[model samples]
Target: MTETPQEQTAADGSVAMQAGRDVIVTNTTGLTLMEARQVAIDVFNANFIRLADEAASIASARADALREKFFDRLSRENPEGLQQAKDPGFQHAFYTAQKEQARTGDADLGDMLVDLLVDRTKHSERDIRQIVLDESLNTAPKLTNGQTAALSLIFLLRYTRNNSLLSHNALGEYFDKYVKPLASKLATSTASFQHLEFTGCGAVGAFQFLPEQSLENNYRGLFLKGFDPQEINDRDISIGLDRRVFMPCLNDAAKLQVSALNEESLESHLASLSIPGEDVTKIKGLFNATKMNHEEIRAKCVELRPYMETVFDAWSSSNMKNFTLTSVGIAIGHANIKRIIGEEFADLSIWIN
Candidate 1:
């Protein structure tokens, strides 16, 4: 590998301000700065990012609560209360219910506004407050705010309560198939509360912004690692850092991104998906099926069960299932089909070892 150029520290590398407040970077570490003031800027930025992440998490929790509250009460699944559901006054009642729910949260959500509001001064609270308290009672199809906003959230729960996206039957099927099984798992899970893979923690794509943003994240890291903040920042010039160290790191960052690295199987959120309950039901029914009476077939079934179950487990992530096929998807899918349709159809065992 070609060596990084900026990592070549000078013979007597020292970073100090001789004249004024201008910052400079020195040394070979290629990671941090060498000035007190610059270090302070990083400190400030890191703290800001932390606070921002917390606020984002809280806002996400509130939106989830709102979705649940609306669907639970007004969902027009199959009901004896069709008269009120069909009544023209239902729109008013729905909005009124939402307003009431906003003011008073249920047992699951604790107190919606009170529980979610991290700090009064945070800008997120203002947005949430507007969402909760702003009275847009009119249920017309057009814009109710009397402005032609570019891209604003338009929630039409009143219109969809009967049969659209939130159709009672579709939700019920989804609940039974995808959600109900995960309810217990989620309740006990401490893994950053994944609401369909978008965690309350951090998620970002390819972002291009001012170097200040980069400094925000890195400055905090330096402080946390017990580096001498002043010494580090004093020698670290943004220009040298950007050209010599930072730019190079950016080019190689993607390779080091994920928690682990392996070539065992390529995985994608897309590819074909296995039937959810088929493997489980097969395992459950295997106890009674006369189809397994043949000892040879029975042994093969037993051997294939784990792979089938793995397919089931891997495919269970709703956030992952998509339209594309990956190497990982193919392996699991072939196994799943073998288990489901019998080995006569899926002659894939030869490819496994």
Candidate 2:
């Protein structure tokens, strides 16, 4: 029997977060404003790099398991055909399946009779197209059956994991110590409003107010900022990415439906974003107009102080602590996508800071 996958505690969910939490906790609290800011930045960079390694390791293990299972099923079902499917002839067979799919619009490519004849996989469209083209060609194909199979397994693991980094309960005890020293510095910084409100948003009180809010938007924002969804662009590792929030509303039975949402569904959701607040608008406009240097940003921050003050008041208040994105903060946040981003997310509407 298996070891039940080692039920991950709130503590051991993410190694990066564990490290970050430790760094923050271990670092002294009496530092100056600049020192505290540097500490936060250091934590961010360490977590970013750590998440990259963790994501790759997770992908590798998931791929290995999938590869074994895929071939094992083939061995049990058709021992003789499994060997034959490795040859170039399988490419031709895949084309035949594609032709049939095109003609009849049948999904599953007639029970996946061809090696590379999948209509869809839990991978990117670009990756799927590359595999399809490789299989269609007769000579010097870019991918072989085994290679494509391995790639498919990796892609499946990535898609299911949600973005590049695997998220379990992050921001556990790590930030608890740092929240105070960092709060004043963060409050003065662009990130003040978002971080201030983030703490209470995860509470049951938040759900009571924004009951009609989409489950995705609920946990997807400020609270989960540390969860990096690192993007891989042609082997380049671009940091500062955020991912979709997990199944906040769904039980185990409906989890499959959440994973089944296709690219079209994702696009539909992306097209609709919240409107930005005046502060975010001004910051974005200044940014777009003149590159938004530090002096200008500082000036804008002064003007935006009242809005941040409201957020600070709510955070201090016991009753209204678990509030949604207040009308005052979103504008500044919308335009101020620098480090102010509660989660380093770029796709905010007016509602989120």
Candidate 3:
């Protein structure tokens, strides 16, 4: 559900694009540059908070449901074991099952499960609400009031819907219309970016991109510009962020495959598509970088070809379709992380800014 660089526009007359279901137009045309930038930041913050809250709420509900189902199953299946301490086998089996179930949940789920195990019925929406509220409060130091409000709006837009946010077009459009303005400001603000290093952002776009980092405890600040990624002890090195992108040639190839009437025909059609060597190389490098096995990547390419082709067809017919990443005026952050790991134990939170 991630939006490729081709699927976004700046909305500041810097770029005017309609990506899928969302339309991003230039909104900074009339206002002073400063006003335009502030407006963009406000919109971004609003969208961010909204998305964050939605993610928290969805995560909370899912975690609670899982906890209830698991404990209920455990209670029913191991009714007699709780009263006795002698059945180590039953205890081990129960715990093993619990562990497996817990694997399906993420960080928020883990927190919810601990609360549920402590007191099942006592856990409620209020508990999750409080956690989310606390998270917001903690993040407040990193954002302006306007930015916070913008984030809250974005969260509500996604959360109220019952369906999954699978449509990249819709998410992209929302960003273009509402979030792009703010993104411009944030991107331009050295201070905001620096502060955001510690204050993780809410999820946005189809990929649910969050500013959270893996190196939570190792955060310091940005190193010297253009520092090498190989020295882990160097104070200047930073952990790289993971930004997923869907390739253009692969996308085109996918389209060709889908329109074919049969698997054989699809393969034939795909074979005929003239994908560029650079794009193919980029795609291969992307797959390798993500640690995807060659066979799996090939299979994925085949499976995804059809939908991607449809996307391309739609894009070709309108302004929305004519977009490319370079045209979007947004710089996608890409870093070679293995090289980074060799160089630094430092957190990459600074890069989020």
Query: How would you encode candidate 2's per-residue C-alpha lDDT over 43-130 as one tens digit per residue?
Result: 4333322436666465334333333433444445344333332223332333333333333332222222222222112112344333
Local distance difference test, per candidate?
0.25, 0.28, 0.29
Please count the clashing residue pairs in each candidate, in the order shown. Answer: 19, 9, 30
- Model 1, residue 337: distance off in Å is 36
Model 2 residue 137 distance off true place after TM-score fit, in angstroms: 59
Instruction: Give the per-residue lDDT of model 3 (tens digit) for 25-64.
Output: 3332343333322332332222222336666566435434
Regions more than 4 Å wrong, model 2: 1-327, 333-337, 340-353
- Candidate 3: residue 112 lDDT (0-100): 27
TM-score of 1: 0.15
Error of 2 at 201 (Å): 17
How many residue pairs of model 1 clash at the backbone?
A: 19
- Identify the superior model by lDDT, candidate 1 or candidate 3: 3
On lDDT, the leading prediction is 3
Candidate 1 wrong stretches, greater than 4 Å: 1-105, 111-113, 119-121, 124-353
The weakest ten consecutive residues by lDDT in model 3 span 215-224
